[model samples]
Every structure is written in structure tokens, then in C-alpha cells.
Target: MSTTTQNRLESRYAGITLEGYPHALSAWFIVALRFVMGGMILFAGLGKLAFVSGEPFDASGFLVHGVDPASPVSGLYAAMASNVALMEIINVVVPITQVLIGVALITGAFVRLAALGGAMQMAMFYLGGWEGQWLAAFDSTLIYALVFLALGAFAAGRIAGLDRYIEQIDVGGEPLVERFPTLRYLLG
Candidate 1:
């Protein structure tokens, strides 16, 4: 191509050099989303953690708070509400899983694993009882779930996080993959 043509192309596109982001500055937007989502997930876990302070968070509230006729999953949640053993187990699992997922997402270590877990959690919330008007577009929980899944699919963490460094390391005795084979699916 001629220098003039190349210059024109560069000028037209300006800073944005990647797909999905229109402007050069917009590429960071992806990482920014990851940060925001990670922070929220982390805080959410803390909010449910009992020893932190005040009243302990109880997962049973998920079922108790809603008896809405419109919610199709209300019956399932109601059934869970009756089982003390299950509720107790869920109460413990929810916070722990959320914390793990949050930490993974924040550090961009095993991002795909974190995102997949986040997606599952959000999907549960959406199905259990996310009160919203969108029957077609999707509610906040579902949106977050999709976001998590998308991040995983793209390995969005490699953008500006520790996952990039983790991808580079290797030892003679055992490759990173050999030590943690499942990480192959989780980290990108």
C-alpha cells in the first residue's frame, strides 16, 4: 500500500487496535468490566459471611423472601426452604464459593474457572427469584451470568492481569500443565 493510504487508515482508526472495541481507548473497557464485576462478587461474598460481624447471612432467605406467583421457580425454592439440612449446607457453600470465585476473578488467576463459577451462581439467582420485568432481555442476575461466561470464553483476564504472567511460566521437571492439568481449561 502507498504511504498516503497507510497514513489515512491509521488516522481513521486512531487508537483502537483490537476487535470489539471501536476506539483505541475502549480496549481497557473489557478489563474494566472484569474489575468491576470482580469487586462486586468479592463484596457480595463478604456480605453473606457471618463471622465478619452483625447477623450472620443465611441462604434460606433466598427462598423465604419470595412467594411470588409469577416466579416459576418459587416452588423449587419453597421446597428447599423446608429442608434445614440442605439450607444449612447451602448457607455455608454459597459464601465460600463466592469468595473463591471473587478472589480468582480479581487476581485474574484461573479466570475461566472463576467466571464459570460466577456464571453458575448468577444463573441460580436468576432462576430462583430475580424479580424483574424482562422476560425476554434478561434480568441483572442473568446479565451478570452472561458477562461471566463471555469473560471466560474470551479469557478476558489476560488483558492486564496476573493470568498473563501465569501463562508464561514453565519448569523443567513439570510443565505448569502437568502439575495442574485442569488449569488448562480454567486459565486460558
Candidate 2:
């Protein structure tokens, strides 16, 4: 290819600069973080669903006292715990969300939305653990949430994925994307 064409191709494949972000090292680092964190979330969520077959569980009795039906967020947990089938389904859905977020971050497709979703899932997971008074169990979920928040806030996918293409089409930037700039990283 001609030098011009080669350069163009390089820019396209390696990543095109945008507002001084694309190709930034931190962007790639965030991508790697998303990949690892996403996988971990997917694994844990799937494990929760799979626990029934491997071990005995009474979702109703999973958490009591401070986090039980009497606690502040008891209604929410009750809603979740009440539906054993739904909770089980959440297992499949949770991992699927993780897998998709991982794929999006790695491939740079719909990155902002994917990352936001992952963060929300992580927050929920963390809350679940917290309510149960299990900080050790909450740590991983909290970490995943922070990673996703970073990926979303920084638009890491622009470095080498479909996020760039999405940006060109003016579809990636949303209200949530704009809002991310203001949110501090508490989970990381």
C-alpha cells in the first residue's frame, strides 16, 4: 500500500485519536480491567445460579436481620428472594451480562452502555454482599463495578474497538455517558 494508505490503515486498526483519548495507555489499561472484571462478575453471577445444584440453598433464608425483610432495602431483597425461579434466571442473565460487557469492552462495541450495565450489576452484587455482612464476598463485586465505571467514564473502547465506529455515527454518547464525568470512583 502507499504510505498514505498504510498510515490510514494503521490509524484505523491501532485506533484513531479523538479529543486526545484514543490510543492513550490508560484507555487500554481500562480495557484490560474491564475484560478481567467482567469475567469475574460473570463467573460469580453464574455461580450463584449454579449453587442450587451443587449445594442446598433457601433464597428466602439467604440473608436475615439487618438485610432481611425487615431491613431498609428488605423490600428489594424480598422481591428478589421471593422469586426463586427469577433469581435462578438472574444467574443466567447476570453471567450473560458479564460476557457481553467483556465482549463489548474488548471489541469496543456499545462500550458506554455495556460498561454502565456492568457497573450497575456490580453495585447490586456488592449491596447483596454488604447486606449479608460479608465484606470479603463484596470486594470482588465492588472492584468490578469500579472497573466498569472507569471503562464507561473514559470510553476505553475507543482505543481499539467498535466504540470508535459508534462514536463516528454519534450514537455512543448518551446522558449517562455525560453523567459519568461527575461520578467519583468509590468502588475501585
Top model by lDDT, which number? 1
Per-residue CA lDDT of candidate 2, range 1-188, in tens?
Answer: 22322111112335664333233244456667766665665555455544534753334554333353323466787677678787676646665676676666656677777778888876765665564554354477687788777777666666666656544443355543244543222111
Over 1-188, each residue of candidate 1 has an lDDT whose tens digit, in order, gives: 22322211122256655443244543377688788888899889888887774677776776867545457778788888889999889888888888888888778888998999999999878877655456643778888999999788767778787787786678566667667777778785
Mark the regions of model 2 whose C-alpha exceeds 4 Å error after superposition: 1-24, 42-71, 131-138, 169-188
Residue 76 Cα positional deviation in candidate 1, in Å, after optimal superposition? 2.1
TM-scores, all candidates, are: 0.77, 0.56
Q: Name the lDDT value of residue 124 in candidate 2.
A: 68
What are the root-mean-square deviations of the candidates from the true structure over C-alphas?
A: 7.1, 10.3
**Clash count for each candidate, listed in order shown:** 2, 2
